[model samples]
Target chain A: MTQKPSRTQALYAWLDERLGLTTINKLVLDRKVPKVNWWYTLGSATLFLFILQVVTGIFLTVYYVPTPDHAYDSVNYIMQGVRFGWLVRGIHHWGASFMVLFVFLHMLRVFYMGAYKYPRELTWMIGVLLFVLTLGMGFTGYLLPWNQRAYWATTVGTQIAGTPPIIGPWITRILRGGEEISALTLSRFFALHIWMIPGLMALLIAVHLYLVIRIGISNPPSKDE
Target chain B: MSSHNPHDLSRRDFFKIVSSFVGSLMGLILGLPLISYFVSPALDEQGGEKWIPAGPLDNYPVGEPTLFTFTLTKQHGWEKTAQSYGVYIIRHSDTEVTVFSNVCTHLACRVRWHDDVSEFICPCHDAHFAEDGTVISGPAPRPLDKYEYKIEDGTLYLHLVEG
Candidate 1:
């Protein structure tokens, strides 16, 4: 008589049949990255920073208040009152800057390598979109503190957005949620910073990663193809 | 793929229906609280005016404006915050009192009472406000904001928004 498969083997076979888990592992995890130096890691680093930002931002939201009246005080309370709140906020604050910096550096590396040329145009375009989204996140998050610097800086920033040829005024009004910055502006910025931009970024990042994997990382510049 | 027997097909269909029902029930069990947590802030009621007692009228000396500080509790969504509010109380007479917000009109800096200069000086932009809350000099675009105040039974109450 034929022997029955072991319990572990049966379970694995069952999962593999439905999910093709092993095939996914072979295609994704076992796929080889180019044997370039440390420069290839910046994209992954930027992704890591994005995750860190999301986690810390979620923690901050527990105590943060997005309102003109209490935004500043709530930030102060987070930085001072909650346990290890300073560490979380500090990491989030610095992580945002690092994310922007790393994304720029990664783009620079890709551009310098001419990876944007030929078959990788779509990848490069998605990357550029991600860069703009990162900037949007920074701009939106800057106003959450609602202090003098945050207030005036946002005012000037929105005014600059109001300087474009035809769409300037509309952009400013949409960003500010009205003619001037008020509680509505704070609410808009908060929504964009915490959810909308991040959600779009996540989707774009997934697509960018899929494209990169499908196209493969471009080879380093060399004499031969 | 292989063809299945009718008896086996019916059994599989029953399992599929049962699994989907269980999956939907599980999703409902997990999703309701998360949805509520996300929407709680938008549904919060955080508006209304509350008159806060700054201090007694007798505490202020005549002519010389004294700063009265009071704690204003603000509620935003689920968070309750207490911010210190300060106003310059100028007692002109026994019944007449003028209260000016310490916030500078130029850039919202806290203006302090300078006894030597005899005018409120904004260290931020060097703006000056006279004892009567008018802009005396500097980049201030308007006079200091006068908060609505009322004196009742020797106690001075300021009409402030409590979240």
Candidate 2:
């Protein structure tokens, strides 16, 4: 026959019981985790894309200049001087496009599955804000090249923003730095793109995930039940 | 509950099925690309300064402006993009050359060389520039930007901006 365990082992067992690791495991394994469809993979994919963005973005930030005069040249230097810089830039550019695509798809998945109802409403709202911020990142990054296309596109974009009602002129002036796309505008957009928007995205993502965990995953509404 | 028993797989069977499905999907998504990278020929292109000859010096006659067309091929990371630019090379003399980008200072429209008037005219917004690339009239606030150039063996080589 086997002997009884020592006092130390028994004490550790009691602590584990109080912590309820077994109970948590049962909850995770038994409590339905929505075996919906492949659409659920989108959230995990978006998270993966975000991680890729952060890594590539950090690599780019090491070479990118936020200034107006040198920003374009510095990017060129990276492309010409650095090892595998072109591949890095291509990955960054393509990754950005993919990030936007995945985010939009993720939103659609949430909508179609009715995952944004009730307690997840705030999470949906945060996701929407993150979507807009992603667009902001794209627009701001487009100007960093300082080429003719970048210059003209930014000019047209800011001019369009100036068409809004009351604060149109003020907003355009603020965006362009003086009724037009200038060096100041490039500097401002650089700051916002690299720092401001990324910071907000991180905070919003954290809050969004917190809400998601708090409410847990929503199950599909059944017709027969 | 009794009727649903046949449809439900055992826990071990379910785990086996789900894990294999997920593993295969992950492999398709990630593994194929890694294998392709090793097998691909295009992945081996190096990144460095590529010198493109814009035109022969004789093509740009003295005291006349002409458009020098050249193609720029670049590899940015994994992507290969080719772009072409028509640059105005004004041969002020045999020794002095002024290179102006064909892109209009206003809205980036292509400015044309009007031989009759001896000026660069942008039809988009009526922006005008003299043979020297200074803004002669209309909406262009800045002069046409000039590119750095060098002459070797009577051929004009221009450094195309990369980014």
Candidate 3:
């Protein structure tokens, strides 16, 4: 008679049969890569920052009221009253700026190393889209605080978008919900910041990670090739 | 292979310990703050004391007590709320004034001034207090609360303490 496998081993075997968990571990966590420098870590760093932003942003929504009247005061309460709220918000605030910086740097790294060529071109394209979404998040989130600087910054930002011809004005009106900044504009930006943009970015990030794994990390570019 | 060598094996063990420590450190750095962040609202407290203006001293007629009501706007979380407070003011002179809170000392019900009975009457529980706010006949255990006041220039100011 064969001896029974241990409980954990049996569970793992059962899961492996249905979910192919071992295959996933082998493909994702144990995959081999060519020798690379610290520059390769930039992409992962950006992803880490994105996760941080999502967590802190959700915590903020606990106290954050999207209305213009309450927005500034709510943020004030979070900073002053809520314990460690300042830290959470601080991480999210700095994380946004750093994510933008890291995404740009990661792209620059890929560009310089010529990692965007060949089979990785689609991944590069998706990453570029992700970069645009990152900027979109920053733009929408900047207005949520509704403080003096944020209010005026958004005003000028929308005005800049209104600088073109007829279509430019139309875009501005759509963004602002009218010819000027109003409560509707704030709620619209809030929706996009919390839901729409992040949702799209998450979908794109899954694709980006998949592509990164499928094509595997590119070899450091040779001087000739 | 070097992978099986003792020296390489110890180096790998060192890396495992270092990575685990760093990973746990990262979790601790964020995890503790996150616990506080979620439970913060329960820990919030807002209170203060300040001298609030009760308008010009000339507004109150000397001799009898008059109900003087003032409004205070306070920051309650995200809202600015206007709380109305009242005090019975007895002006002995332009600078000499006695201020008694409109609240009954017993159950915190509002006590109205009865000119005929010459006392503050608490309608909620049939409690009464003399003109000086001493409990006359009721379940009240103490006199009406008094507030400190001062006169500067033409304006009369009263101290507001909140918790």
The digit string of per-residue lDDT tens for model 3 on B16-43 reads: 8998999899889998999888887566
Residue pairs in clash, model 1: none
In model 3, where do residues sit more than 4 Å from their true spots?
Answer: A1-18, B1-17, B45-76, B80-163
Candidate number with greatest lDDT: 3
Tens digit per residue, CA lDDT, model 1, A103-194: 99999999988889999999999999999999999999999999999999999999999998999999999999999999999999999999
CAPRI category for model 3: medium
CAPRI docking class of candidate 2 = incorrect
Choose 1 or 3, whichever is better by DockQ. 3
Judge candidate 1 at residue B114 and give its lDDT. Answer: 94
Per-model DockQ: 0.02, 0.02, 0.53
Question: For residue A152, what is the lDDT in candidate 1?
Answer: 94
- DockQ head-to-head 2 vs 3, winner: 3
Worst 10 residues of 1 chain B by lDDT: B29-38
